[model samples]
Target chain A: MDERERINRLRWRCTRRAMLEMDLLLGEFLERIFPTLGPAQADAFIILADMEDLELWPLINGSRECTDSVQAEVVALLRDVRVK
Target chain B: MSNSSIPVRKFDAVIVGAGGSGLRAAIQLSEGGLKTAVLSKVFPTRSHTVAAQGGVSASLGNSEEDHWHWHMYDTVKGSDWLGDQDAIEYMCRMAPEVVVELEHFGMPFDRTDEGKIYQRPFGGHMSNFGEKPVRRACAAADRTGHAMLHALYQRNVRANTQFFVEWMALDLIRDESGQVLGVIALEMETGEVVAFHAKATIFATGGAGRIYYSSTNAFINTGDGLGMAARAGIALEDMEFWQFHPTGVAGAGVLITEGVRGEGGILRNSDNERFMERYAPNAKDLASRDVVSRAMVTEINEGRGCGPNKDFVLLDITHLDPATIMKRLPGIREISIQFAGIDPIQAPIPVVPTCHYQMGGIPTNYKGQVVAADGVPVKGFYAAGEVACASVHGANRLGTNSLLDLLVFGKSSGDSVIEDLATGKVAHQDLPENFAERTLARLHRLNTQTGGSDVNETRLELQRTMQKHCGVFRFKDMLAEGVAKIVEIEKAVARTEIKDKSQVWNTARVEALELDNLIEVAKATLVSAEARKESRGAHVRDDAPDTAENPNGRDDANWHKHTLWQREGSSLSYKPVTMTPLTVETIALKTRSY
Candidate 1:
């Protein structure tokens, strides 16, 4: 799929959550930052999307550090993009 | 023309609070061809049920030989024998079926190698008459409740259940003849008040864990249903008994599920001592939650605690393989890292007992019929889940049973309502005159009332007082003082004013209203706790010393019955626990031990 189609596909995945907090954080990342991602960042975003909300929430909250550098950088970008 | 003239809508059944129980009941009701409406303070998925991390208890015998008889014995013993044996028997017997139904409903529970639903050991669960830890808890990678909530919500959606999201029920509409008509609810989006007229009204509004400052409960858990029931002259049973989970993240009361211990984690003191071994030789860390919580408190009190200032213990799971931690306890690892800044794969997490669940609520029967103080079923009213006592958990809830309670009672309650409707038993009572008057007057008072007390400040004080005086260990004087202080707080709450007068999505107004509910719960807990003299289950009294025969100095001879605390004059009554099971022999009361 093309980049736009890929981002749209990932956006749909973000809506499936047991928590709205995760939805907002993941939704904002997809809408604002997904289209701008390169191939490596797109893979990282996919990993982030697949994680459970409890794990993803901390990454978005900047409380815990992710072990993977790629996931870490993408999560940091999402954190920066979030309106404080 | 006035607030009393709010529009009224009708449904066959109206369920308040769209968490697991409410959604499960909605699914059943809707599938049964009943027009059901589920009102939730937040979106259905956002209810506090999603925060539950451990598994649901059931004698599935998936991993080993287990029976509902054994489950009943453990639950009754876990409640310190204060639980009604009949209700306990019903819940235990219904466990396996309810769990299987949830699995069939597409709940993504972890599977054994044979593809059966996975099970794990939890505190107070045993096999062969408490001989060993049994894998009784049906799990989905420590996110059982989340999976269950999602599955039930999906099922409800497929069943075409109508959801009134972000709508808070203000009061129960009772007729002069003492039958519940339905409820007056506020729509948060438009700030419009509406009345739900139904043949039956079910309250599944979860627990009041937020009565304490440090609790695993979400902010939305303000005991709205309990408050409404109490105001409508229903009794809150055994309000003294609140479960304190042993492994809450230190300083942050978010839960670290006992599933950690069930997965081979250990609790250690500063000397690296497994203290639970000293307390409960067999179950150790897997003892009843009340026992484990009391042990932790005792360890901290004796200055054998692990963390700095010796105020907390350590939940050590570093011995577990990293992969197992990753797969089974991913949520615990994340919470430990974020809240306590410790990863289970590397180091121990600082932990302390935190307010987790309420073992008390509006008294109900096994069939989800809300009963009056005299043990008569309130016509047209029902309750299930954590909000209703049913005198099942009694004084202390066993871990994992809370979710199981929700499933069994929620489904049974829905079926009961269906039966009532089909049999033409539920009378279509007309809306009584001035039904909306009290509800509208209260809303108007909050909206137009000027400043006297701030909502947030009074709420904080209420939480602080409950946390300080009515905590894991209570004393006679402290509890007495707590009762008086709660009475004062109630007065202050009544005078509280809403600062923000915005009609649409005004959270300040909601908080002010929720504070009223929280205060009601706080008073019920403190006052009821003060009245119960003996230490029993989660209602441990510091002044009561343990004897050679009685564990926790539980005075079963005098205090075995359920405390029914009503709002009228804050009067306290007692109801005898039905000791006889339906078919099996009664599990005779013994000095409860792990």
Candidate 2:
């Protein structure tokens, strides 16, 4: 329920993925991503975490656009970080 | 003051790894009224033993006429006579008793129509001394290893065995008198290094198949025990022979158990021809692992391979009834679907031989005591499972024999420990003041080092090198080159460092430690493989062809003995194989053609 605990939980979920490419993209850029999260991006991060790698990778990969306004803000932030 | 910071724990016995063998040994040690500690990097059930599909070998003769003698014969022939006969006889004779005991411990064994434990034919399990295939593998469907681990762990819990889960052991501790004390381990949660002093130390750390680029082994099978032993100047026997299971799902390296073939699955080439008939006439799809693996590679090399790249063959179980596949090999079907994206009942699974098991490790006697190169037992040190070479498997291991080796030798080590304890002479020796120095130094290096070779990249290079050079077929110059390449890789391993330095639950730190162990295995394999000129068991070289006079190119005159690789000076020595059995006549060697 606390903000710090929720952010830590989101970090754990983001870093661990079945596909290595997703793990590398999310996990390798982990230190950089967490420190720079804006308030709006922080609140909407769970929406991205909820999506499976099969659905999420393409969205971050520029194949599709985020439909929801708050979700698009988080996706735009992630799209800036280069995948390893 | 320095020693005060590190906690020291003492037990009557400490067993590394909680696979089938470790749990089996723990049952005896704890139940026999001795304090026991079983340490594993993973949870007890999640160990590689859980990945064992197929079954355990037992000559209960449940399905048809069978005898332990025939099992011993097939084992000797299957081993290509590299396995010590005494150990082979001991394991075979003890197989029935162990399997039955496991059943009594609530193991879920499949039953025959008469309500007897069901058995299936596995590769190299023949009846009447290689006359015909026999149903000798006692299975719980295809999840035999999983069932066995659960059954054994449940028993261990009831026996009140102490478990150290998520703990990684770093080094084997031996007193100044050359008597083994115990190991210095790291508690993953606290990152505290502790010395687990014990009267007896049993290493059941299993095999290191991950040294190869593609392997069927779980990620945790990193030869931890072998590494610690080797670093402590212990000799590793028969390091050249590694088995390639005939059916790993191509590209994914997930194992499709040999049990599939035992249940009437067939391997076919691009032309839909059952090509094993040409390599092994009598056994065909049910030939020993090495023969089957080689035949598949040869088929692929000659361009008879299936799939788009023509790099793999096909394992077809379409002919088997769907009901039977569902009943007997449910796990195999699940793996085929999950890994290869093909269901066996609908289509053939793409298959290639991938590194599966190490047929060698720390040399031990039938009693599970780790032996020196001169045949003397190392004081208070014991080993079982894939980490110990009782030399029963010799050059090539049979399918179900692995589970048998673990259970029999696991109990053997435990019984030996209890008897040794009963003598009242197995006292705890004084630990050296600097017992934890080597362990601390390694940990300190990992913690402090910042700029160095990345751990994962170095590991990938090591695996790719092993896969390229020491594969199904070997060449003289190629193996020599591989040896040189591995020597360079070892240097890279030494320089490799981890970036993650957090104190709690550091998996990256664990991986770096495992890499040190993997390099030892990779070096031993390549070095021993290059020196041995003969083709025996899984170690077949193209230069030494199986000619009419040569008969599988086994140079018995020159290379019949076991190879002992030493860490000091990176040297290799030879030891004679025990030809006499515990009881009955020894099985003589002949031209081994399936």
Candidate 3:
């Protein structure tokens, strides 16, 4: 699939969290943060997508920070987008 | 063609709920060459099973020297000696195999440094029969159930098992000879009513935890299978015993898994004292759910509760390493911050006892065949998971055993169905002419009924009444009053009207239908709880005095047998517990204390 199709699929997955709180947070992140990412960052976004909402939610909440630089940057982006 | 003349769809086997158990069974049946159909009220992934945060129990001996026999002993004791030994032995023995099967199916189980499955200690899991806490819970970082359900769903998809998402089963269709024909269900998207005619029917529709106002169950866990079985003249076994998890987030009632305690989390009161150490000195924070819940409630009652209202206690994990918290209990951290707005790594999460699991359900044998009060199997009918009382978890289920029960019994039932089908003995029983009429009429009544009482109001009233009377603690006067009040609420439920006229994707209509089941479960729980004179396991009664032998005030002499609730005139009966296992010495009953 092309980049647009991949992003759309990722958006669909974001809305399907097991917990409703994660659903809202991830949905917001996709809508606001997806358009600003380059190809490598999009790949990093997919890596973050692979993690369960349980892991991803905390990274964005700043309660637990991600060690990986790519994941750390995505988490920062998500937090930034949430504040905006 | 008119909608009334909808043709029936045929399958070799039909499974309800599509959660872990239903999907597991569907995988087996489809792989066995049976045309299987799984009908679920929500998308398969969105089932209530996804909310389970702890690991599945297995004596894999990965983290410690553990054995199934020792696990069996803890389970029997945890159940307060009410669980059938034969089924307990079977489940404990199959735990390792099934957990391994899940691993082989690409379930993301956490691993130790040796590359074997990582095991965590859970409440009531011991090594050498009450020696010490044993590492038996095979985890996937507090998302074991999520991984297990996804793995099973994937396997079912591979096996080509047909799925009917967003379809709610209205009633069980039975022939005149009392054999299960299939079920009549409502397709939520189009509001079309359809019939599934199968040679065999399985009810894996989970528990009725939603009956209680403060529960960890999802909105969909209305005990639909139990309601259908009871309405179809099947006796619900042991409906009174409800497990109350001690660590639900205070106000929200969302679950904080027992894995938290397993990973060294402690329960503290308002005075900053570790209170479980007072109740259970040996097990401390890792006592069985019932023991811990009672301790928490007692602390709150004694004016030691935390928070402004003093209604809840604190679960402290701030002492644990931040890396460990993030790696092992990430979900709990997320849940705490999201639900309670408190992060466990920084501050303690406020929690209280919440209704978690139902030990009683549609009465079934160890083989998963639904049995009547006479101990005879209902032909072509089966049950598994939380909906079925295979009598494995007896009065209080040990943590992680719920997921294990789903896998072991789910697969057993599927195998039994395949064997029965291979014999060509249980052919498709013909449905009566008006089989679908009753179910259709129920839908019609809900679809067209004007205002009498709001659906949400009636449901909330039932929840409040249940929470008030039938809670962690019970007394004679309170239980009797609860029974009477529930009966009055039944009328309120009957008079409840569904104002949503649209048939397509009408959520109001769905809630209305679900309330029908919830009321049945609530009534059964209250009535059965009131009738049981003694406190056993989760059914702790304040009025019942402690016996010399039984420290918990459990009167096993009169109430040792399971209580069976039959819907015909709403009566009760008793069935003997199968104490003898297939090939092991009976674990003799003893006064249970942590």
Interface RMSD of 3: 6.8
Clashing pairs in 1: none
Clashes of each: 0, 0, 0
Task: Supply candidate 2's per-residue lDDT for B182.
Answer: 94
**What is the C-alpha DockQ of each candidate?**
0.10, 0.05, 0.11
Compared to the true structure, candidate 3 yields what TM-score? 0.83
Task: Tell me each candidate's TM-score.
Answer: 0.83, 0.81, 0.83
Error of 2 at A62 (Å): 32
Residue-level lDDT tens digits of model 2 in B1-594 = 265578889998999999989999999999999899999876787677865677999899988999999999999998899999999998999999999999999999999889899899987899999999999999897678878988999999999999998789999999787788999998866678899999999999999888987677756778889889999889899989998877888766767877889999899999999999998999999997777888987788689998887878999999999999988987677657656768789999898889888999999999899989889888889999999999999999888899999899999999988887788646688888888887788788778876777899999888877876887777788899899999998988887787768766666787899999999999989999999998998999988997876888888989889999998878999999898999899788687877
lDDT of 3 by residue, B111-203 (tens): 899999988898789989999999998888867778888999999889999999878898998877789989888886777888899999999
Can you write out model 2's per-residue Cα lDDT over A1-84, one digit (the tens) per residue?
445445444554454332333444455345577567777766666667656555686676556888788778767666565432
Identify the candidate with maximal DockQ: 3
Model 2 global lDDT (CA atoms, 0 to 1): 0.84
Once superposed on the true structure, which residue ranges of model 1 sit more than 4 Å away at CA?
A1-84, B1-4, B256-337, B340-351
